[model samples]
Target: NLRFNKVVICTDADVDGYQIRTLVLTMLYRLTPTLINKGYVYIAESPLYEINTKNKTYFAYTEPEKTDILRRIDGEKYTIQRSKGLGENDPEMMWLTTMSPESRRLIKVLPTDAERTAEVFDLLLGDNLQGRKDHIAEHGAEYLDDLDVS
Candidate 1:
């Protein structure tokens, strides 16, 4: 396996982005759990909106942040730009605001609760997790050991 010091997941700042990010994290959690356990996995935090007044520019991550920024400025005077996806951002803007080392935001993915995370992934994978849990409780490790070895 190719070993990397870090894995950064960059997605748009929206519901779809969140879903895609979750799927990626789940895959990594199962396939390369050490990546998370070693604090090498991260999610890039891109802004949902960029608000620019005549004097200043602000990046907003949520609706409330946008609202608060607008409330502080003259709505008619300032221009508010919402990012639909990462592609919508210009390279300079994306780099300076989302990718630059000095000001960029990143959320490290750590396996604080591996068991719960595994359970959640099982649920996401659908139906089988509950059955597996029930089966384990009823039959115990002895039953699992009895399965035929290939």
Candidate 2:
């Protein structure tokens, strides 16, 4: 057994990513609420931007936000960078964006209706292929962009 000081879930900002994150959070909350309450788990803010400044650093979630933040800062002395994914960053950056509690963003898991959650989990991860297919087909249109046809 490994002793973990914290558990950080890093996922993409897509529907699939959201679903995976939700599933994990649900599992953790149900299985180990103490860990959650103790602040042992976090959801890393996958940087939408990698901004550098002389006095302060920032991570913006949108291009307009990045522009706004940049404008508010001393542009002459600051450098702005954008990160497409966590993989683009090095170990230190990853640690700064995800591992460091002070600088990172943590998403708390909330309790949900057990019956609905069970039904959803079963439909998504169950052994029944047709059930999964039907569930996907029903809600698939809304999240088509998340699917990789290839």
Best by lDDT: 1
Regions more than 4 Å wrong, model 2: 1-6, 11-40, 52-57, 62-88, 113-119, 148-150
Task: Score candidate 2 by lDDT.
Answer: 0.71
Worst 10 residues of 1 by lDDT: 112-121
lDDT of 2 by residue, 12-102 (tens): 6545666777787778766876766666776765767868776677887667978888788843577766565666668887788776768
RMSD of 1: 11.1
Q: How close to the true structure is residue 8 of candidate 1, measured as C-alpha lDDT?
A: 88
Give one digit per residue, the lDDT tens place, for model 1 in 1-150: 547766889999866787688778878888888878888888899988888777888898878988888887855587777775887778998897778979889988779644355665575566787786775677677757545567
Error of 1 at 24 (Å): 0.6
The C-alpha RMSD of each candidate to the native structure, in angstroms, is 11.1, 4.8
- Per-candidate local distance difference test: 0.78, 0.71
**31 in model 2: Cα distance from truth in Å?**
5.4
